[model samples]
Target: MLAVKLPSKETIKVVEEPIPIPAKGEVLIKMKASALCRSDLHRYHGKVLFDETEEEANITPGHEPCGVVEKLGEGVTKVKKGDRVAIYLGLGCGICPDCLRGDVMLCKDFQCIGFQKNGAHADYMTIPEENCLLLPEKMDFITGALSTDVGGTLYTACKRLNLNGTQTAVIIGCGPMGSGGILMAKGFGAKVIAIDLDNKRLELAKELGADYLINPKEEDVLVKIKGITHNTGCDGAIVTAGGSTPLNIALNAIKKRGSVALIAESNKAQIDPSNQFIRTLNTLMGCWYFNRSDWEEIANFIVNHNIQLNKISSDTFSISEAEKAFPLFDSGKTQKVVFTWD
Candidate 1:
């Protein structure tokens, strides 16, 4: 089997290794497609941290994955050989209190698949059977791979906001996750506005049903959003960029007492507490991985063609071309890039 391994910062090496065998209650999958995400870039640049105690040689870095089950270990009965599935990246210890509450991402022993363990950038990978979600018969590998991250993250953000039909929503950044938020908000019957510096991404947001698109570099984002909402401002804003600008924009654009759902990966930021307090902002929520219910909902929505995963996915690379995918994504020339084994 061949896998892309990050031996160190800014280094990716392709190496041949023996295919892994599934342990008890696990499944072995032959990967079909996996996506390169901005988070992967963070890991590549050494912006994202990993446990130093863990063996770095064992680390594999592609997490947004879809594959076919090749075998199942003992006690695994939910899926069988040949099942098409999307592997959940968060590998939570099932015995934790948080896991018991169905919030596996919050588990004390939580470890993400691509970050802490060997992931799907390989021809074959192994995962606990419970982490795999069965894909619909017609779901293609590319779409399924995107659902593992882009679609799932958007779903989780929307879930955090508890969006209802009457709310007005704005999404900052218009990358794959931000664009996904536009579709998710629209599906929930909210008036959606998308903000991005890139005209191409802003145009794509319009195609995905954003009622308005704001280019912050050209227009005053807060003013435009306020004007669109009849000066009331958006009921909620999802900040999908980690930079200080998008966070401030989201804070300024949201309605008083509204929520700000942040899905962007950030380490630190300069924030104004006074402004947040004056607005009586209900909360600033951080949404990362999806729960089991969120996974099921997103899968069903994609299967029914409600939220079009196929349209959001823009580029494809083979496993050998993984290096090129990151640069293309960083250039903002593509929306979502998937690497395939076939």
Candidate 2:
């Protein structure tokens, strides 16, 4: 088997290794497609996003992966050999309240694949049987991989906002996350307002079905959003841009009692609660990733709505090209970069 190893910051190597066998209650997935995420860059830069450790360089770094179950381990029944599935990144200690409810990402002992363990940037990887999310029959491997993070998070975020046809959703970033939001929110029949300082990202957002585009670099985002909503504030806002400014704009762009879901990775942010949400009776939620329970619905929604997940992918590379892939993705020159099998 071939695997990607980040020996150090900004270093990538494709190494040959013995194919791993699934352990009890686990399954071995034959890699088909894997998507690179911004978080993966932390590892690329020799930084750890979780517990401190010197073992930061060996773990493979592709989280969003879709593949076929080529083998099943002892006692595995959640999925059988040959099942088409996408890997759920979180490996939780089952029986906890959070894990029982399928919100494994929130488990107190959450071990994220690709970070804490070997991931799918290889020809094969092993995962607990329960983590296998069966893909919709008609869905492609690329789209299935995307449904894990980009699609699932966006769908869960929009659902949290209770978006619908009568409302407007202001997406405060036009990167892959925000672009995915355009697809999901539009599928829910809501009007979309795409905001980004980058014109290219905004244009991509528009192509993905944004009803309106606003470049905060050129105009007052609040003023433009007000105009689009006819002086009334938007019904909801999803902030994917990591910063206090974008968060504040999203908060103030919504109508009284409206909602905001923060999906970006921001450690600190400054905001006036009284003006942003306290007095307005607004709702704010920190949405991480989708619940394991939502995987079926998320996959179904993508298939049933004909969501174009690949439209957001700017590049694709084979695992052998990891050296080339990481640099380009780290450069922030692409929306989504994927690794695919022949």
Candidate 3:
């Protein structure tokens, strides 16, 4: 089997490794497609630390993945061989308080597939049965791969904000997660605003049904949003960008008593208490990994065609080309980049 490994920052190597054998209650998947996400870039640049030794030891790098079950280990009965599936990268201890309460992402023993364990940026990977979700018969691999992370993130954000038709929403970044947030907000019938520094991404948001697109470089985001909402401002805002500037923009654009969902990964961010208090920001929700409910809802949305995952995928790369894929993603030139074994 072949796998893409990160030996250190800005370095990727494709190495041949022995095929993995699934343990009890686990299954081996022959990967068809896997998306390279911003989180992967964070891991690559040594920004989001999973293990201090990850930088020194070679580790597989991927999470958003879709595949077909090639083999099943003892005690695995939920999915059979040849079943098309999407791997839920986050693995939680099922008996933990958080998992028992159905909030698996909050499990104290949480171990993510691509981060703490072996991931899908390879020809084959092994995952626990609880972490695999069967894909619809007609769903393609690319979209299925993305549903594991990006789609689930949007679902979590929407649920946290309690988005509805009467509310006005804004997504502070127009990357994959931000774009997914826009689509989800539109589905809820909320007036949606997509903000980004890149005009191209903003345009993509408009195509995805965003009512307003604001590039902070060209226009005052707060003023434009206020003008659009009749001086009321957005009812809810999701800060999907990790940087400080986008976070501040979200804070400024949100209406009083509005919710601000922070879905992006950042090492450090500063917020002024006065600004938060004056705006009456209702919540600052953290959306890192998805719970089982979030994954199921996202799966339903994809099956019902409420969200278009294919359109948001900007590029695809082969597993052997992992070295090239990381740099392209870092360059900010693509939206969703998938690495395929097929």
Measured by TM-score, the strongest candidate is: 2
**lDDT of candidates 1 onward, in order:** 0.83, 0.91, 0.83
Q: What's the TM-score of each model vs. the native?
A: 0.94, 0.98, 0.94
lDDT of 3 by residue, 1-342 (tens): 889988767888899999999999999999999999877887788665555354434568788999999999999989999999998777787898888766776877777777788889999999999888888777788888877788877877887888888988989988888888887778767889888999999889999999988898999888898899999878888988887888887777777887888988787998876777554745677877577755666788777855787778898888998888899989997898888765
TM-score of 3: 0.94
Worst 10 residues of 2 by lDDT: 52-61
**Which of the predicted structures, 2 or 3, would earn the higher lDDT when compared with the native?**
2
lDDT of predicted model 1: 0.83
Best by lDDT: 2
Candidate 1: minimum summed lDDT over ten consecutive residues — where?
Answer: 49-58
Error of 3 at 191 (Å): 1.6
RMSD of 2: 0.9
Q: How does candidate 2 score on lDDT?
A: 0.91
What tens-digit string does per-residue lDDT give for candidate 2 at 1-342?
A: 899998877889999999999999899999999999998988889788878356745788779999999998999977988899999999888999999999999998988889889988999999999889998889999999998899999999999999999999999988889899999999999999999989999889888999999998899888888888899899999999998999999999999999999999998999999987779999999999999998888888899989998899899999999899999998876899999997
Clashing pairs in 3: none
